[model samples]
Target: MLTAPGSLKAECSNCGATHTPLWRRGLNDKLNCNACGLYCKLHKCLRPKSMRASHGEGRRSGASSLASALSALASVAAPPPSSATPVVEVVSPGVSSAQCYNCHTTATPLWRKDEEGKTVCNACSLYYKLHGSARPISMKSDIIRKRSRHDARAQRSSLTEPPSASNTPGTPSETPSASPGVSRRPRPV
Candidate 1:
């Protein structure tokens, strides 16, 4: 009858015979069958535990001891599932999406992108002269439209002014000449 040390039944797959399973000390020595003449493949019974425990440098022989060590190591190493608190990311409303011009931080309010694809914040834009010589900053659509309108008004006023009358040949001299008054006689003598 294939039985473990404490009445545990062990069956041999090869011979269809049952025998008492011995406490496996190591590979190649776990079971002995008198009827079919087969020795227990200790690997079948004890190799898995040995493999788990033998991952360390030290060798462990008994299956029970290896299993115990593995269980203890798992308990020590594995982290418990946490249910304490949930993490959340907060975004503020009405804030500028542009980051700081000098620093790449997302904190600055007046972030603008230049034609060269540089993102400058208000502080950086004000301090650094990237507009005059360098490429102009890309403004928001609403701001661009407002600036266009203002420029159009200025152009229209400039065009409406007539050319100066001084350009004509018959134009009178604007400089005033002294009249033939009585003031030229030697100060009433």
Candidate 2:
């Protein structure tokens, strides 16, 4: 049971048992496990509010969420009864038989096992046939594809482009070619 106000239950660091929860002292940061009489070593950061795999180091346990850790500390009751079935009426459909692997839709009129041996629904199968790629993100974006194509063209051009002394960087060309087919000539005298 949590004793201090705003204090949460913490598992015994030594025995790793939730039944023997300990209260942490703010000043010295010591764990007071009354059940096991386990006291955290007096150090700057021996044991933080968050539990860790090892004494002070190793991966931070329950780093994903403190709520999850708290939930784990809470006592869980027994699960409810089973045998809850959903009722559905099949309309003027073909003999609904196969169980889909992907969607898990039972009594599917038409279902087939995928290469990996998962049930695939009829509509899903048709959709997959029309548009490949399981996850949309798995397929390269159109913008990315276009950009890659442009980059490939640029790379080929760069490789094929002969080295020239005129177009060198830092050293500006004598005159900027004003327009195509119009050469820079001396002004009319």
Candidate 3:
């Protein structure tokens, strides 16, 4: 049902994307697809064509079915062990399967102790520390957000890089223009 305007019939100048939710301008005012434009804006370079996805293609593919079939065939073709031994797992005394005191969730990336020395999940502990109160149960979510961490070396190199003439200290371009849907916060001194 979604259709592009007649003027947008041309493919993206960078990634050659024929379809995009939104069109954006890139270097030299060239027409770039949404993904390419965002990538270029963040990295200050054109997006690599290798990262482009085929239209209507998905992450799941025939290769996964072939891999499953091969695994099943291998399991059937292999002989059973001559002697089967019972496997036992030993848990250390210091480690306990404790649930978070606040959220009551058993799973967490890290566990921390509350003011009363009760086990609490990382999120609950951090929230309580920042807000000085227990995190609302209504705010709990099943999905965990993955964050991309920058390498220390890359961070150091960027910090050391000389500022361009347009973005030099005290220049009008020193402060970045606010992008739509993104909030700008002043850095702590």
TM-score of each prediction: 0.19, 0.19, 0.30
Give the total clashing residue pairs for model 1: 8
Over the stretch 1-189, how does candidate 2's per-residue lDDT look in tens digits?
444335464554443444323344433444444322432434533343434222322223556445544554443533554678544566666566555555545643456656687777655565677877342323322231123787889999999988778767766576667796675554599
Which 10-residue window of candidate 2 scores lowest in summed lDDT?
137-146
Q: Which candidate wins on TM-score?
A: 3
- Expressed as tens digits, the lDDT of each residue in 65-155 for candidate 1 is 5676677567667466578754445568775455544455565545777557778655446545644543233432222122388888989
- Residue 160 in candidate 3 has what lDDT? 100
Summarize candidate 3's per-residue lDDT along 1-189 as a digit string, tens digits.
122356736577876666677778888888877768887899888976445544422122558645654664665574754568534466698665678889888767889999899999888999999999999999887777665566767888899998677765554554556785454545589
Q: What is the lDDT of residue 183 in candidate 2?
A: 56
Clash statistics: count for each candidate: 8, 5, 0
Q: Which ten residues in a row have the lowest lDDT in candidate 3?
A: 52-61
The superposed Cα distance between candidate 3 and the true structure at residue 86, in angstroms, equals: 30
**Residue 39 miss distance in model 1 (angstroms):** 59
Error of 3 at 60 (Å): 65
Candidate 2: list runs displaced more than 4 Å: 1-98, 135-189
Question: CA lDDT of 110 in candidate 2?
Answer: 59
lDDT of each: 0.46, 0.49, 0.71
